[model samples]
Target chain A: EAEVAQSPRYKITEKSQAVAFWCDPISGHATLYWYRQILGQGPELLVQFQDESVVDDSQLPKDRFSAERLKGVDSTLKIQPAELGDSAMYLCASSSNQQGPYGYTFGSGTRLTVV
Target chain B: AQRVTQPEKLLSVFKGAPVELKCNYSYSGSPELFWYVQYSRQRLQLLLRHISRESIKGFTADLNKGETSFHLKKPFAQEEDSAMYYCALSSFGNTPLVFGKGTRLSVIA
Candidate 1:
């Protein structure tokens, strides 16, 4: 089955350091999402992209976090000056369209730990 | 604000027994609800959705707007059913999904 791909399954960084994660959604998916999941907590949406354009980033921390989907096919999420509280699993998901029988397919996630 | 709530964080049941994972949502509009499952060492995947109204792998979820609940149920649990289940909701106006904390179901044989 086609699945969402993510890189750097695990990362350990010092506070204030930089970190970048990548995700490649399933082919032909129009919507992509970035979610941050802290231990013992639910995943929170940081950003949503629709065909290379950001549809929503209301919950994204603009000052420290930046995400891009230049071609609408693959996406990258970066955190400059990472904080200890920023440690969590970064999950990327994709959907074929706005709605259907199918729902989102999430990646295994990249676990980032900032010391 | 739209939100999802899964009351129990951990649920333990024996194999061949019934299982139920409760979920509630705080939304005021027509909503699209979904149940997602993540097994050990696996990525999260869709389990079922309210729109389809079809049972999958002996699992079923009914969306109750009046009570703002979408509970997942299975008549008999299997060892393979041990996993983390999340309840998510998508509002009528937005495509972004709001997920609950999740319930970790452990089927002990």
Candidate 2:
């Protein structure tokens, strides 16, 4: 089975530090998403990208968070000056344009902890 | 705005017992409903979708337009079914999914 790849399974950073997470979606997937899952809460969409163009980022904290899919294949999410409240699991998902019955395929996620 | 609601935060059931995870949504237009499951130390994956109308792993969900609900149900629960289940909604366009708080289902032997 083709799986989305994420780097740095776990990351711990001090407040005011910068952190970045990488995700490589399945081959040929056009839609990619970045979501944040807080403990005891469901995942929340942070940004959505179709190819290299962003489709929706209304929920993303533009001041501190930014996501990009430079090549329209792999994506990277970065948070500058991470805050304690930023601790959560960052998940990446992908889906082809067809997007049959089943929804997007998710990555294992990168757990971030800011102290 | 599209939103999904899963009232129960946690549910416990014994193996071989029937189980149902409630889910409701608020959407103006026709929305796509999905149930995603996350097992211990595993990635979140799609379990079923209302559009498919196919039972997977003995679990099925029916979309009720009048009540605006899409609840997941299973005839007989199994220990392996213990996991966190999330209900999600998506609109017609290429929009991001909106997920509910989720329910932790614990199927004990």
For every candidate, what is the interface RMSD in angstroms?
A: 2.4, 2.0
DockQ (CA atoms), all models: 0.60, 0.65
How far does residue A17 in candidate 1 sit from its true spot (Å)? 0.2
Extract clashing residue pairs from model 2. none
Give the C-alpha miss distance for residue B34 in model 1, angstroms.
Answer: 0.5
The lDDT leader among the candidates is 2
Per-residue accuracy of model 1 over A14-70 as CA lDDT, tens digit each: 999999999999999989999999998888999999899999999999999999999
Worst 10 residues of 2 chain B by lDDT: B89-98
The residue pairs in collision within model 1 are: none
Off by over 4 Å in 2: none
Ten-residue stretch with the least lDDT total in model 1 chain A: A96-105
Question: For candidate 2 chain A, which ten residues in a row score worst on lDDT?
Answer: A95-104
- The number of clashing residue pairs in model 1 is 0
